[model samples]
Target: MGRWMKPEVYPLFAAVGVAVGVCCMQLVRNISTNPEVRVNKENRIAGILENFDEGEKYAEHGLRKYVRGRRPEIMPSLNKFFSDPE
Candidate 1:
C-alpha cells in the first residue's frame, strides 16, 4: 500500500537484509568449519577430538585454497606494465 510505505525506510530494509545475509553466511561457515560437528558418519565415529587438521583442511579447500598462493593484485597485467622499466 502506498500509504503504508515510506521511501526513507527502504535503506533500513536494505541494511537489515544485508546484515541478515552476512549473519547467515557466518553461521554456515561456523557450522561447516566446527571440528565437533561432523557431517560424515565415519567422521562422527572417529570422535570430536580427532581430525581437527582435516577440518581445517576442509575449511581451506574452496576459494581460500585457490587464492592462497595467488598474487594479491587486482590487475596484474596493468601493474606489470606500469612497474616495468622502458
Candidate 2:
C-alpha cells in the first residue's frame, strides 16, 4: 500500500474531533449554568393515567422511571454532579 490516503486525512479527522468536543463542552456548560434549560428536560404534560406508546415521554417526577433524560437518579455520581447549589 503506497500511502493509503492523503496526509490531510488525519488532520481533518483531528479537526472534526476537536469541533465535536468543543460543541459538547459548550452544551454541557450551557445546561449546567441554566436551570431553565434543565427544567425544559423535565416532564410536565403527562397525566398519571396517560398511556405512552413506546416513545420518549416524561413522567410527573420530571424523569421517567425506565432510564431516561440522562437519568441522574440512577447514577450517584451524576446525581451529585447535578445537585442544586445552596
Candidate 3:
C-alpha cells in the first residue's frame, strides 16, 4: 500500500474528505431548516402559491440568530493598531 500511495497524498485525501463532509452536513442542515422547502405532501400543494416574504423573514432571523453577540471584526487588536487616534 505504501508503494501505491505516498505519505504526502494522505493530507490531500484528508482535506478532501473533510471538505466533502462539511458540504454534506451543510446540505442536510439547509434542507432541514429552510422554510421554503416543503417536505410534506399535503402542505406542498396547499401552499404552492403562498407569499415568499415570510420565508425570507425566517431566513433573515436565522442568520441574525447565528451572528448575534459575535464581533464583526476578524482581528480587533490588529484593527486597532492602524486606527485613527482617539
Instruction: Tell me, by lDDT, which candidate is best.
Output: 1
Candidate 2 vs 3: which has more lDDT:
3
Poorly placed runs, candidate 1 (over 4 Å): 1-20, 37-48
TM-score between candidate 1 and the true structure: 0.52
Cα misplacement distance, residue 50 of candidate 2 (Å): 34
State the C-alpha lDDT per candidate: 0.82, 0.55, 0.79
TM-score of each: 0.52, 0.36, 0.55
Models sorted by TM-score, best on top? 3, 1, 2
lDDT of 1 by residue, 12-40 (tens): 88999999999999789767876767787
Question: Can you write out model 2's per-residue Cα lDDT over 14-75, one digit (the tens) per residue?
Answer: 89899999999768855654323433424333323234542233223333454565544657
Instruction: Return the clash pairs for model 3, or none.
Output: none
Model 2's TM-score against the true structure: 0.36
Q: What does candidate 3's lDDT look like per residue over 1-86, in tens digits? A: 87749987989899999999999987886777667677888768777556678677756775688889888988888888888567
